[model samples]
Target: MAIPLSWWLTVAAALFAIGLYGVLSRRNAIGVLLGIELMLNAANINLVAFWRFITPQALTGQVFAIFVIGIAAAEAAAGLAIIISAYRRRRTVVVDELDTMRW
Candidate 1:
């Protein structure tokens, strides 16, 4: 019994929706980061799923997914570093409270 492409797409779409909601509803910096991560993962799933169903012989999908993972890791690291620095100075991780740069 092989899994269907539609199923994969459905799952990815659901994940993307959840991630979008998380990004919009959360008031914390870490929550936004997590939402971004979820969205990235959903994109990777779609890329690999399409590649597998459309061109199994090509390595493009897998390669792109790997590249996306690397980029996500780098983004996470940098975002965390900035969040930590902000927390150290502001003492709050709340998005609303961290808006010191807003003129």
Candidate 2:
């Protein structure tokens, strides 16, 4: 038997929620970046699942999801580079430690 669309959507929503929670609670910059990556993947899953269930005949949703994945990869790379640079300069990756440059 095939899976229901509602179930897929629900799972996607849960993934998004978990990612959001991680982003909100994590103190390490890398952890926050991981959360953002998770959030992006959750969105990608939702898009692909919706395409599979709601519009199987069309390719738009899949195409958009692919674009999102590409963009997400770029974002992750850039974010990691920045995080590395920040850690190099600050000697710590904790969010609380980032406040010194807030001025």
Candidate 3:
């Protein structure tokens, strides 16, 4: 017996909600990045689930998920690099503390 699409959707929705909360509540740059990653994964899950249930023959959803994964990897790399540089300069990874653009 295979799992239902609704189960997958429910899991994805829960993950997305948790990630959203983390992004909004966390002050650390790394934490926020993690939350973003989680959200991306949730989207991937939803895409795959829909693809499997709605159109198993079409590879569009899998392709889209792969693209999303690639983009997420790149985003995480860039985000980490920026965070590391900011930490080196300011010695803190907190988002509120990195406001150097203010005049």
Candidate 4:
């Protein structure tokens, strides 16, 4: 027996909510990036679950999930690079501490 779609959706929703809370509450740059990644994975879970339950024959959802994975990888790389550069210049990775442009 397969798992229900509602179960998948509930898991994804919970993951997304946790990620959102992390993104909003974390002050560290890396923590925020991790939260963003969590959100992306939650989206992927939802996409695959919908595709499995709603259109198992079609490959669209799998393809979209793959694309999202690629995008998330790229995003993580770029975000890390930015965070590293900011830390190098400022000696800190706290989001609020890197605000050099604040006038």
lDDT of each: 0.96, 0.91, 0.96, 0.95
**Model with the higher lDDT, candidate 1 or 2:** 1
Ranking by lDDT: 1, 3, 4, 2
The residue-by-residue lDDT of candidate 3 on 1-103, one tens digit each, is 2899999999999999999999999999999999999999999999999999999999999999999999998999999999999999999999998989967
lDDT of 2 by residue, 51-75 (tens): 8888999999899999999999899
Clashes per candidate, residues 3 or more apart or on different chains = 0, 0, 0, 0
Name the regions of candidate 4 deviating beyond 4 angstroms: none
TM-score of each: 0.95, 0.93, 0.94, 0.96
Who is ahead in TM-score, 3 or 4? 4
Residue 97 C-alpha lDDT in model 1: 92
**Using TM-score as the measure, what is the rank order of every candidate, best first?**
4, 1, 3, 2
CA error at residue 79 for candidate 2, angstroms: 0.4
Per-residue alpha-carbon lDDT of model 4 for 1-103, expressed as tens digits?
Answer: 3889999999999999999999999999999999999999999999999999999999999999999999999999999999998888899999998878999
lDDT score, candidate 3, position 22: 91
Return model 1's CA RMSD, one decimal. 1.0
- Model 4 TM: 0.96
The predicted structure with the larger lDDT, 1 or 4, is 1
